[model samples]
Target: MDELTLRIYPSVRAAAPDLETPGLAGYAFARHAWLQAWADTFGAQAHIEPAIVVMAGVRIQMVLPLGITRRNGLRTLEFLGGIVTDYNAPAIDPDFARSLDATAVQALWRRITAALPSHDVVCLTRMPVTLDPPEGAVGERVPNPLALLPGVNAAGQARSVTFPDRYEALTGTLRPRFWADTQRCRRRLAEVGPIAFVVADDDAGMRALIVSLKRMKSRRWRETHSKDWFAVPAFSDFYDAMARIDLPEGRIHGSSLNVSGTAVAAHLGLVYRSRFYLLLIGWEADGWRRFSTGRLMTETLLRQAFDEGLRVFDFTVGEEAYKDDWANALMPLVRYDEAITARGRFATVLMTARDRLRARATQVAWLRRIVRWLAGRPLA
Candidate 1:
């Protein structure tokens, strides 16, 4: 076995060339284009320091897209894409990933963390257990090294609907009543005018759909009094850049449900590695709400996924009830939280307590309602 060495880069753009090499298997979020877009948009607000780990006798083993952000005098090390990135794991060579055991992974992490820039705490979240190769790539799914770390806890779970051999089989997985309701909604929606599910195939169409998405999402956030990420210029820029990014393995996919030549519901997602990552979705909040355009759009997309022979329709990270209603498989996400300094230790303790309180609230109906009410969220 060769010795493993770590190198840190000031920005992802500087590391972009190295990351384009073949044989790397990971989520689209870990790619250079994605990370670079994030850095280009949020660099002024956050400090990005990407690290590459290599085997001395071999080639590049992993690329860690990391960044630091200070809040209330405490610097927190996190994955570069911040709130937008659903999954946070290194883009690693499959061979290198398979070669490591639990002990070796820990040792590698220790070396990598030691080389990271000064920070009060390291908080890595939404990591999956395995990294599957992209479609047409010759490799098996490999274990995610970060998920093997000791003391890692279940942060949350991502939901995905696995396609069956036949598209009709999908309905059997969902509640009969829910499936019927969607069909009813589809019929009602069609009664208004001609209904169609359209995909943005050109740059102009893509931009138009994105604009509609932002508008719908903005209105929704305002109605619910929720924090609107799209309102932030940097976050908006990052998403716009992603939608325009063109890559071989995967690219941003924008689609909408059009009725009488008007887009009423829209979705912006990624089609990567035979999976459709459902990232952003919004529906017009008008009389159309009674038509359930959002639900119809979801069903239409699932059918599209089946027609395209895609394997998974990933709902990304969320605990929403609608996702649970559609998802057949639940991918458990884990987190690695560590304190590097005295202040970090205190912060970690506080974080743990906060997590415990949140968990408790989830288990108690009244407490959960109160929590949602206080946060200005709708109680269902």
Candidate 2:
């Protein structure tokens, strides 16, 4: 933990470390092995921004393949937060994880000073506290996190709700009327047309449904004049592959809400460790006005899950109103960032300046409208 006397060096490669290492899951996503996959597949042009946090004659942690971009002459390094990956903390031993924060902070600062010695800005986005703060003013940049993280420590969370057992336990949290309404929706759906279910397995039928869902989502986004998550080819592939990722390790349950043998809505979720995490969803535009395709799809999945004996049903991060009816528990997602060096400090300052201006603009009702409109677009 002292002045990293060990000759630790930094590399931008994303290779996997020893399996016997302490925190493999934490660093795997950020390592070269994972980042290269993202680079090749996601076209995530990045620098080989590498750093080795070594100790005890072994390589403990490695940080690599981060995007280093200069904006307005500010040399800023983003934490990457594995934009295309997840689990962005250091992988070290239990004992080592305890001392990792301090060692990592010093090592990171040294690397930033050495790599772009003149650059005085490091901007870490959506980083876990386990990564350790660089000891300065910390603030939320975009406020709403770019990605969702399932916080295990929901007890301390303000919006935390109790986790319900799968099946009735979840829907039981809602009003009795809500359950009756669900029954009514089912009856109405039956009255209007036949309802069917298509699950994404390895079969051609499943693959076809996934493809149709993608096309449906793309068209929906275009008609609404909004950007879609799968607009990029890599993301589209990710969406498709997602339907397959859990099948081998655990189980993947991607369902299509169909009517009269025709697909009306689709629910794409990842089922792991007896928990169903709602990922992305799509619906047929025509049926939306008649019957809430999205919510109905949830009911479909919920009943299916209960029948299958699944325990937890996570709606993921958003505090969206619709999730309330089915979510027996509410988990509030939080955002926090830390600057680790002279580089981090300056970047934080620049963000502060920009956000202040935005905040003032939002103070005026009329101006707020424009601010929201512009923000929906892209900001450098």
Candidate 3:
């Protein structure tokens, strides 16, 4: 027990200065490198604040990258990735993992929460259930996590619609009915004009596509009085940084699906871990909506991924109808907390109720139709 020393730092830049870190390419859209790059690009618009959960012995060792804040003087900790990051967890020291068990790791969270009181929300999201606790710890600090949605879209595993061994199993496995429709749509679109896979190999190219995506995504948000965080300076800087970093790291993989040399849809993703993480997306204004370029471009991208031998292709989070139809299957998600207090409990209750309602409604089509009707606005 005495062999380990604990430290929590205020900023990621200062957290693990000398530790052997994986250097930001791993998380692509949400890594610390991305955060810093964004800060540089937006010059203060980005929220670069990060905290680390570290345990050191003779020298600094394992670290858990995180974010924390004090709301109205109440201290709380949050996972840094938020909306932009997926597959997030603390990056532990390999040796640290060997030294600690599930109980001990749980104790670490216990210890960490005991230290912070200024923040009230001990919020955690997307924590895979298989996570282990550390040695000598009960994980008692963790608030019980609930399934993202109960049983509405159940009875299946999140298997690749195709098999891992061969690319054909997956791509060839797409809903045959949909594939037929897509073929017909593309044929009609081709008749209207030239359709293509436009590649933007430079910043200027990426910027143009992004401008289109933001313009399209924002139009819908504006009417609703809401905006994606990227619209803010901080988030935008981070995105621009994505373009600045070298390949397999900060590079932007943006392209357009076009007709008649006009961009009809855009696929905006980032390259990391030899796979592509789907990010912002958009379709051209009023140009052949019947074609479903969004879905077609997705099929094209997935085909490219398989052909390129990339193992995983994440659609990211959200329970959109299209995502459900195309992705292999839905995976359960968990929202966690280590030190939830009174107000936190109330907030959790509200959120739980909201999730349950949404889940129950997903089982029915009418609720969604009503929403679409109210939204009556066309897709932005």
Residue 2 displacement in candidate 3 (angstroms): 5.3
- The CA lDDT of each predicted structure is 0.81, 0.52, 0.58
Worst 10 residues of 2 by lDDT: 140-149
Per-prediction TM-score: 0.89, 0.66, 0.72
Better structure of 2 and 3 per TM-score: 3
Pick by lDDT: 1 or 2, better one: 1
lDDT of 1 by residue, 1-380 (tens): 43665677776777776656556778888777777777778765665554444333367777777777775467778877877788988777787888888898888877777777788887888899888674566756778988988889998888899899998888987789989988998888888999988999999999999999999998988898998888899989987888888765887889999999999999999898788988899999779999888888888888898899898899989887889889998888899888889988887776676557678998898877766665633211
Q: Which stretches of candidate 1 lie over 4 Å from their true place?
A: 49-57, 137-140, 350-380
Quick one: how many clashes does candidate 1 have?
A: 0
> What is the alpha-carbon lDDT for the whole of candidate 1?
0.81
How would the candidate models be sorted by TM-score, starting from the highest?
1, 3, 2
Q: How large is the C-alpha RMSD of every model relative to the true structure?
A: 4.5, 8.0, 8.2
| Predicted structure with the largest TM-score when compared to the true one | 1
lDDT of 3 by residue, 294-338 (tens): 777877777777776665666766545676556774444466654
Q: Residue 347 lDDT in model 2? A: 61
TM-score of structure candidate 2: 0.66
Minimum summed lDDT over a 10-residue window in model 3 is located at 143-152
